[model samples]
Target: MQEKAVVYINSDDSGRGFLGAGGSQALETFVDEIAQNVIDPQANVSVFDRAKAHELVDASSAKAKKEILERKGSRLEALGSGSDFSSFLQHLGIPTLNVGYGGEDGGGEYHSIYDSYDDYVRFKDPGFKYGVTLAQTTGHAVLRMADADLLPFDFRSLYKTLDKYAKEVSELAEKMRENTEMDNQLIKSNDYAIAADPTKHEQLPVAKAEVPKLDFSALKTALDSLKKSADKLALSWTAASATDADKDKLNKLLFHAEQQLLSAEGLPRRPWYRHTIYAPGFYTGYGVKTLPGIREAIEQRNFTEAQQQIGVVAGSIMQLATYLAKPL
Candidate 1:
């Protein structure tokens, strides 16, 4: 094992206890807190830190790159070199910390000459101030993670994501209905806007078009029920952490909670992916689909199907809520 370096864990973990048990109030609190307090980019932006590292060898000579490389006793570059900490941290699910300093050096040196030490010292860590900053940030992370009483995962973020997806699916259903209604009226009226105002008028499309009204009452009721369940679970879990009865209830609900969110038939087009919280949209690759059943149903202009899907999603939500409401 290489020398261990320290790192900070700044993530919020309010949802761990509720992971399988369903939605917990703690998870909601986590999301709320994050939205309220944003992390500073200079201080917390890990992605930027990673990107800045490449400057360590930019526009410089091989001599400089090699010098820094040798001094640091680290490779200037490693192909297929899975960074030591990444593979295990990311793949094995072990938390990881990647530490490095660079960015002042604009010295670029591809596998060629022109790469020399002449440029690195003058450019890369000019005063090495940022290097110190990096160290401080790293130390902060290590201390936070090591000292925390619990894992740092945020449940509120998860809930926010879910809420946004639900609204999106509902909106899709509305839009599809409107378009279909417009198409029907277009054929019935035989009045193309072109014919009505052939002079290229820019007034705007006519209004008062009636689209199918989706019955979200079922969904609302389901959510309300689930919220109640979540509250119940929080009360029970908080009051009796050591009770087997509470744990048993939570464990039983865990299986039902997440499972209830999935449709045996899967999304309308993509049957391979399941799971309500995380799924690939049929049209959007690499993008997540939330409340997909209803969303996809609307996209396909299937009102009856869309309406049915709302019930399905809502039922899942309620199931999860009930699970969370359990004693544990």
Candidate 2:
């Protein structure tokens, strides 16, 4: 967390990258390597590793350079940033760039009891330059997203993310089924009289009753159908440019269409959040539980519940695409 630490290269912040051994060291190495090799090399020697506050702040260049720096840090944090933005950037195919400023927030009540007007003025962002950096960084992101025609959504990234999650859920269900069989065996081996308890049952907590084999056929069908629907809508939007009125209406409608994917009810229990695309775990506050309905079902050992949620989510996806398919 260097003062005025700037990144040298453009990065895609996945937010789950720091999950293994040596993650912090790796982040330091990544930033140090990129700064030394890329950014510092390109800039005037005076700006090369100044190790102090930037005396003259250039908002425009800082904005561009900040993106590069944010990307690099994002790359390292992707190993594990431990925030709500993780799944959207890492798993949901969003080309996310985190750009908040001030290293002081990294420690000492910055995010806890210590972070206050007094502490901020006394220790962190004393000059308010970092706050300026934050403003510039946010403006840059907003401008980029607003001006871009493609909405910055990359379905390929989302597809891969979903595939991995699906595999994890499938494996968990299998493990539960395997454990159930093991329990049945241990029970049969017990001596007949003592094994059957009358008042105080000593029977092993039954492994979640064998989970039935799920037919992912329905899910695959739904995904394929949605893809076709999305493709059609994309084509329509592109063709609508011929009519100014239609184009304007299409743009506005398409812009808000994604918002429809969310459910105000949120997950089964947690209600504070509303986005259907992502959510925090009910138990793991800051941690994301992607496809919470299915993931939690498996984690809770509720196989039938998991299957039901799968259908629910699959339906949601298709419905979103169908909504997108409408002509403005």
Candidate 3:
């Protein structure tokens, strides 16, 4: 029996290669590393490296090219809720992988009664070569997971991704402040009435409250502390003297680390979905809400709720950092 396991999933009905959702950074890195390393057999190059080279040639602008080239690997888009991995990752906090191949298929008959073998072979994966590719790619992932002495849970990438999300929410608040100020100014000046045609009677728009300044310093400080702790943990795990017991302890820590991101109270209205970092948007269905508690509060113009959520998220990060900082 395998000491650890890697589940390989292929959402045949799903369109395109690896439409990942939930803990996307971790899963994307996992899949991308495997895809990039496994030779395409026919193409004679790693799938990821080939894709990267093509992107460089097809890039339209110097800035775009630079950004593409600077990227360490293929960009893994954030997961929303359209696949089977949602339950395992978001609900159970399991480190799972969702894999598939697409981009060549037109998906003309997707989810329809007419979607059959003829449709698949005719439009999607004409030679069934991509099907083989998917198996080989995921096979490599399973082998790596099963055979490796230590699991590959890259906290550095996770920290980097989370840091990016933090900056985005902070900037979102700042941008809202500016927009609200401008709207208030226009309302005060009766700009709408002034701009209205003389023939038509246009009602003045109601004024909204001034956007309050949000304090994200706590969140920022917590993130910094977490990054430092992640770096230290990475070093300790990779150290030459790390024993089997030490590795086992580290693995357990890694498993529970993601669970710490969950809030006991959950989001403002949604208690079932507990992940503080990622959740499906309340209104957008499948759309992802990064830092949902804070992002949604700000989006709805609820500063009080936003402030409360900030503290909650910050506390979670601090707790995780403290756990990671514990001596091995």
Candidate 4:
């Protein structure tokens, strides 16, 4: 089996966008590099085209050109469980890509008998334009992977994305604390009873304990270290002096980087799904829960568990940084 790259083209007719795909760290970068370079023939533009336009439009006139020039190629969604790429990415730690096209086609015939070829042709892509487009897009991606001298894996992007998730989890904890405090205060003051009319019966909210402060120092420190290490790795990889053996060793390390983010014990009550950074929400099912271990624990108001998970996730981040910092 080829260790270079893996691409999966899944049907996406939800009208959200062209396609939303993701994978483990190395795979995520591999797919994104291909998507950014491959031009969308139908639109007569690169897949990165719209993102550039959006950035330019959002920026001030003076900075617009600069923003467009510096902007990275195609955006990638975080990979959650519940897709064909799950086993290849989450289990085997292979570089995998799940691709598809959508955003102009919308329908409600999913999983029904009406979801036939005729229905698709009539309601989805008439004349099969999108089908051909998807073929072209994924085909180009496959060719690029097959031909590239070094596997394209962007550790910088991964570090930035993970850093964002860490911030989000910290913010989530603070927000939960604030909300809990507000609720407790409202109950203590009997505001609910005061707001109710004498003629109508009302049940007052029960008084609850205030949420305790969470320690995010460890997580923050780990994320900072990870970012520095990632920056160094990215620089080293892009250097002209780097050799093929160096690239190969770096790629191998990246391939297993995502594994460090997984815990043997898994998220609370969800042992089968082991990704700490991204996982399918237990209640939302298909929806993604970033920093799942910490986010879900806080969501359920399990402060003790949340604190424990925070340390666990911090350790994982530190481990990943160590791997990247190791000499190639």
Candidate 5:
């Protein structure tokens, strides 16, 4: 058995994880940082961020274009299963990333007759330039990670990502509360008139139960602790000057830091996925659900479960923070 895992990176020319790549914000930052050094004239790569709307980051060779990549959006989408990175990140809590170029091709090729040489030249990659650039870009990522003195990881970025997810879940609960109240008010006012046939009287739908306010204090407190711990780790690592053997030992600890996020019980009903941070949508087969326990509960209108999941996710985050706080 291996003592520790360094990192996991999955790159596919055709198939990739659903929605976007699965990783901490640091992973996206690391990839973008290295990609800037790649001088590719043909394949002007643009990065899509964590947001569903996809604020683009142009990681091209040009100076103006490359600078814009960081300013706009600089994070990766939460990864879901259906690609190679799933098992590593979800099950084992390995620090994972999926790197590839996509979202540009307009769906037509299926590796079938439509994907003929003529169509490929016109629609897909024009001159196989993207392929060359892909090799160069991915190559640099691999080499840098393999050669870095101290496992090129930054926990501070991860703490910020967790903070963002916590806020998003709180907002999700709030929005649900607002919508539920409005719908219930409409029900009381008897506003279920059929649009197609106003004359055809229909039974009014039963009023939904009012969404109660969820307590997010636990989550907020946990995130605050995480921020402090992450900052401490970052500051110490920057100043440390250790022997090669000591550095290797520290790298091993960093390698397994993500494993601290896993819960023994796992998500609501899925025990196989232990990580609290990223998981496949139980219903949206090909899509991702970040902070799955909390997000999915809110989405399914299970406020009770949502309340409980907030604690679960908070505990997990706190555990990760505590793990990171250990002397480096």
Candidate 6:
């Protein structure tokens, strides 16, 4: 049997901008390095980051999102337990990335009667260039992970990414509040006359209760601590040198850092899954929920549960921050 390299990341477009692709910013860069080495600089590429990374969600600003895509890449999409990497990532809390390459191919050729190696070789990726690109990208990542003394798990990148989630959820709550108020105004003014269908008799929609003012102070505090610790570690990362033991210790710590994110009582009812930061949505199956506890609760309009989940997420973040603050 021919030896093959383990490909952890898939580098492709989902492709309007980078919507379906999922991975870390660091790993994205790692994969991009491989692609840059092989693929032409001028090669036509498509990306997807336009979507809010959800099924019910749509891109907020196409022009602004595309600007981000043109500059660096997509907003690092979260991992869903839909792939082979789920166990290593969502369950065990290991770092993961998804990368793939494609953009030349257009619509019509999907998973149907026409998806074959012959057609792929002739039409999609002529000369199997993408196949080479994929090989190089995955091989290099594996090689680096295997050979490096210090593991490439950058917690600062993690902090920044997570901070965005914190901000996003806060904003989501506020947005929901505003929407609810507007709808309730319409409901009150029209006496709940709005029905699904104007012609047939349909149940009238009720005025939604206001999205309560959620106290995210605990979460905010935890994130503040996490940022400081992450910043400190990043500085250590840049220091002149360190003993092999220290580097090894730091690597081990980084490796196990994900464990700190596991809520002892995982995700409301699904105790099997841990790792609080990322999880598949209760409703959106394969679509991931960042800050799942808080995000899902708010989405479901369970203000009480949302408040409790906020505490859970805060505790998890504090656990991670405390772990990161450890001496090298």
- Candidate with maximal TM-score: 3
Candidate lDDT values, in order: 0.46, 0.47, 0.72, 0.70, 0.73, 0.68
Instruction: Give the worst 10-residue stretch by lDDT in candidate 6.
Output: 46-55
Candidate 1: segments with Cα more than 4 A from true spot? 1-164, 193-212, 237-260
Q: What local lDDT does model 5 show for residue 167?
A: 87
Predicted candidate 2 versus true structure: per-residue lDDT over 171-247, tens digit per residue: 77788778777776665665444566677765554423556776555556656765666567656645654444434
TM-score of each: 0.48, 0.55, 0.87, 0.85, 0.84, 0.79
- Give a tens-digit lDDT track for model 3, residues 98-186: 55555454656667988888877766656777677767766787787766566666667777887898899899999999988998899
> Could you tell me the lDDT of residue 210 within candidate 6?
84
For residues 1-328, write the lDDT of model 5, one tens digit per residue. Answer: 1244567877767321112344756576676666556544333333222222233343335675555554643556678888877778888888887766556645766767786777766666677765665676678778988888877777778877888888898898898889889988877776754333556665657788888899999999888988998788777667654544457656776788888888899898999998899999999996888899999998888989999989988898888778888875
Worst 10 residues of 2 by lDDT: 14-23
Model 5: lDDT of residue 228: 93
Candidate 6 TM-score, true structure as reference = 0.79
What's the C-alpha lDDT at position 168 in model 4? 90
Question: In candidate 4, which residue ranges exceed 4 Å CA deviation?
Answer: 1-17, 25-32, 51-70, 197-200, 240-247
Per-prediction tally of clashes: 31, 11, 3, 0, 0, 15
Ranking by lDDT: 5, 3, 4, 6, 2, 1
Candidate 2 clash figure, as a count: 11
